[model samples]
Target: MKPAAHVRKTALPGVGTRYDLNTEAGAHLSVVVHQDGRRIISFHDPEDDDACKDAAALAPAEATALSALLTPDPVAHLHQHLEIDLVTEHIPIGRRSPYAGRTLGATQARTRTGASIVAVLRRTDAFPSPTPDFRLALGDTLVVVGTREGADAVAELINGG
Candidate 1:
């Protein structure tokens, strides 16, 4: 899982300081701050993304300003008006099935709390976008997506508790 993007620090006129970050898509970022508060952030990707450019263009003042904008409070406000869809579904597991003995199936089933199960997991493998007839086995895991509550319910059902 990728760490959420955040502002780390604002150093005073410093000796060279650097911070390393990993992006969501598995990329590395190296940022160096100079004594004068100038920053040089480099991205490891061969093809530059807009984030890299934006980071590079950020001066200390701009970085601080951007940091404020990215803060949790302000970001939360921005999302206050956005609507998120909530969906839920139950997947049946067969008795004496391959997935019946394992928690993998239960854990996967929990993921359906507020979402739809678009597939299944069977013995260390995933059935991406499984067909409706994909019979769930004792060890088979359910692939679910929905709101948090729906996912939790599915998980509980799968656990048989």
Candidate 2:
């Protein structure tokens, strides 16, 4: 059985840091930060409670102070919730990409998207369980198991969008 895909942690200078995040609902997050001492934190909903609370708990003075310390840019949080639906939404991708090249690992992929690729499709053929080495080619469709937006992103990547 293949593992899952998720966001891994990476280091960034000037900006706080970068991390590959996977939402519990299944989605991919590619985060970046600016050199203005600003930090971009992206993660799953369940994992972001503390940060949310911290932000919510900030008083006017505290907010101003924190804003002064950090960049003035608005914090971007991507998630599928009833209140704030920034992105398209979660779309399930049936399985992993059959043709693979520099594709994310199973564990990493799952961590980010919450869906597993149970099968792979190559041309008119289908692979029930694809190995890690499977190289993805252009025009090769991937049946990912994620949210609608996640599926769209995968499709875009495959279609060179």
User: What's the TM-score of every candidate structure?
Assistant: 0.32, 0.30
lDDT of 1 by residue, 1-161 (tens): 45667544544354677676666677767677887678777775536533453347467645655575656663556566768755433344556344554434334543444455677755447788765445566645566677767776766666564
Give per-candidate clash totals. Answer: 20, 33
After superposition, the stretches of candidate 1 with alpha carbons farther than 4 Å from their true spots are 1-114
RMSD of each: 15.7, 18.6
lDDT by residue for model 2 (1-161), tens: 34565657667765645656565665545444445434444433454533422212333333334555655334444232356423322222323533245453532444545545555655456666556666544434345665666655555544434
Once fitted onto the true fold, the runs of candidate 2 whose alpha carbons sit more than 4 angstroms away are 1-100, 103-108, 156-161
Candidate 1 C-alpha error for residue 129, in Å: 2.2
lDDT of 2: 0.47
**What's the lDDT for all of these models?**
0.59, 0.47
